[model samples]
Target chain A: EDQVTQSPEALRLQEGESSSLNCSYTVSGLRGLFWYRQDPGKGPEFLFTLYSAGEEKEKERLKATLTKKESFLHITAPKPEDSATYLCAVDFQGAQKLVFGQGTRLTINP
Target chain B: GAGVSQSPSNKVTEKGKDVELRCDPISGHTALYWYRQSLGQGLEFLIYFQGNSAPDKSGLPSDRFSAERTGGSVSTLTIQRTQQEDSAVYLCASSLAGTDTQYFGPGTRLTVL
Candidate 1:
């Protein structure tokens, strides 16, 4: 079965602190890996899509890097505004199904 | 309108009551999807619709959960005789195509007491 696991379940960082969130997965084949930001009481907002190992993408203060078996979302100089649940998901080959990780809830105290 | 939107942002009902959640996707988007997110958990795929083809319902947890898309624009997820375990935020999303990246809506939080 395709599955995704996120580590550190939760993280607390001081303002301007930098850290990384990890997402590991097992799938038949990787079509694409996606990263999303979700706020309380809201749906996820698309962040980045990494298609191959060694690939990376960035947006504002967030950066996503992918490997054959896992992906990491790095936040640089994060602010309280960046605090939210970061989710990583991979689309399984041969289907529209996307297996999602449990997600990392990052809190940046201002 | 501007992006994917779900109706009835918050719902509270007793167990065994039927509930319907609505999702309006962006115009011209050919692919629509539904998912459920429980408190402190990840998103779980529920269903998928692409254009006029039959939807992918393999992810639906049970027969009690059913859905339909009308005119390729608005989709509705109907949970019949809902259970307390069904308490979760029902999310809707859409993409240009089933193979493309998807955009999500605000989600409807259902609280089954």
Candidate 2:
């Protein structure tokens, strides 16, 4: 069975704090890993897609890195405006749909 | 260019009723997808349509859920005999041909009373 698990279901941080959210997966024939940001009552906004181990992508203050079995979303000195639920999904070989993690709810106190 | 769009931003219906949710994918995108998100749960894949090929319905939870894409652009997801467990946010997304990045639209919140 293919499964994706995200740790630290919820996190509260002061403004300017840096932290990392984890997404681990157990699947066969991994194809790609994706990261997204979702605000309240909205659909997820695409962030990055990592296709192979050691691959990394960045946008503004966010960076996503991938490994053979997991991925990490690192936030750098996050701002209150950056607070949102971060989602991770995996697309494996021969699969037409993505398997998503539960997501990490991040709150940045201003 | 406009991104994916869904109609009926909110829908509230009594149990046993039926409902339809619509989605317009980004212009020129060849792939469209539907997903469901419940409170505190991860997004669950519902269906996928790619160009003129048959839709991938493997992810649909039950026979009561059905979807269709017309002209390879607009899609509709219908749920029959709604149950309380059916209440959730239904999201739509699209991507370019042979691409992995999926841009999503504002979801439709469905509530069953």
Candidate 3:
């Protein structure tokens, strides 16, 4: 069975503080890993997609890195607007569905 | 361009009643998906539709849940005999294909009392 687990169920950070969230997965074959930000009362917003280990992608203050067993989402100098639930998902080989991890609730206090 | 859109931002119904939620994927998008999110939980995949191919409904929780996509554009999810446990946000998303990045819409909050 494929499984995804995220660490630090909740994080609190002062504005401009930097931190990283973890997502570890166990799957037969990894096709892709995705990151998303979801606000209250809204659906998830796409963040990044990592297809292989040693790969990284960045957007503004957010950076996503991938490895064989885990993925990390690093938030640098975060602002209040960056506070949201960060979700990680994995697509297994030959599977059309994505398995998601319990998200990390990040709170950036300004 | 308009992203995926779902109708009835909120729906409140009684147990044993039926409900239908609609989704309009981005124009020209070939893939559409449905997911459910309960309070404090992760998104759960419900169904997937790719172009003209058969839908993947393996993730649907029960026989009461059914979905259909018409013209490969609009999709509808119907739940029969709603239960209190069925209350959750039903989210709709679209992508170029199953392997593409999915764009989500504001979900429809369903409340079964």
Candidate 4:
């Protein structure tokens, strides 16, 4: 069975603090890995897509790196406005739908 | 360009009732998808429509859940005989042809009483 697990269900950090969220997966025929940020009462906003190990993408203060079995979302000097639930999803070969992780709830206290 | 859009930002209905949720994918996007998010749970895939091909219904949890895409643009997800467990945020997303990056719309929060 294909499964995605995100660790540190919730994290609280002071403004300007940097941290990393983890997303691990067990699936066959890997295709792509995705990262999204979702705010309260809204749908998830697309962040990055990594298709292979050693692949990395960055946007503003966020950087995402991928491995054979997992992915990491690293936040640099996060601001309060950056606080939101980060979601990870995987799209495997022969699958039309994405498998999502439970997400990491991040709160940045000013 | 406008992104995917869903109607009735919120819906509240009694148990045993039927409800329909709608989604309008981004203009020209050839792929549309529906998903459900429950409290503290990850988003669960519900359905997928790609162009004129048959929708991928493998992820739908039960027969009570059905969806349709008309003209390959707008889609509707209907839930029959709603139960308390059906209460959750239904999200819609769209992507370009042959692409896996999906852009989502603000979800519809469904509340079953």
| Worst ten in a row by lDDT for model 3 chain A | A90-99
Candidate 2 residue-wise lDDT, A23-107, digit = tens: 9999999888999999998899999999999999999999999999899999999999999999999988888888899999999
**Tens digit of per-residue lDDT, candidate 2, span B30-89:** 999899999978899988899846458887889999998889899999999999999999
* DockQ-best of 1 and 2: 1
Summarize candidate 3's per-residue lDDT along A1-110 as a digit string, tens digits: 78999999999999999999999999988999999999999889999999999999999999999999999999999999999999999989877878899999999999
lDDT of 1 by residue, A3-106 (tens): 89998899999999899999999987899999999998889999999999999998999999999999999999999999999989889778786778989999
Where in model 2 is the C-alpha error above 4 Å? none
User: Interface Cα RMSD per model, in Å?
Assistant: 0.8, 1.3, 0.9, 1.1
Better of 2 and 3 by TM-score: 3
Positional deviation of residue A77's Cα in model 1 after best superposition, in angstroms? 1.0
Chain A TM-score compared with the true chain A, each model in order: 0.97, 0.98, 0.98, 0.98
- Considering TM-score, which of the candidate structures 1 and 3 is the better prediction for this target? 3
What would the TM-scores of all predictions be? 0.96, 0.97, 0.97, 0.97
Fnat across every predicted model, in order? 0.77, 0.82, 0.77, 0.85
Q: Candidate 4 residues B1-113, lDDT tens each?
A: 89889999999999999999999999999999899999978999988889856458887899999998889899999999999999999999998964569999999999999
RMSD per candidate (Å) reads 1.2, 1.1, 1.0, 1.0
Overall local distance difference test of candidate 2 = 0.92
Docking class of 4: high
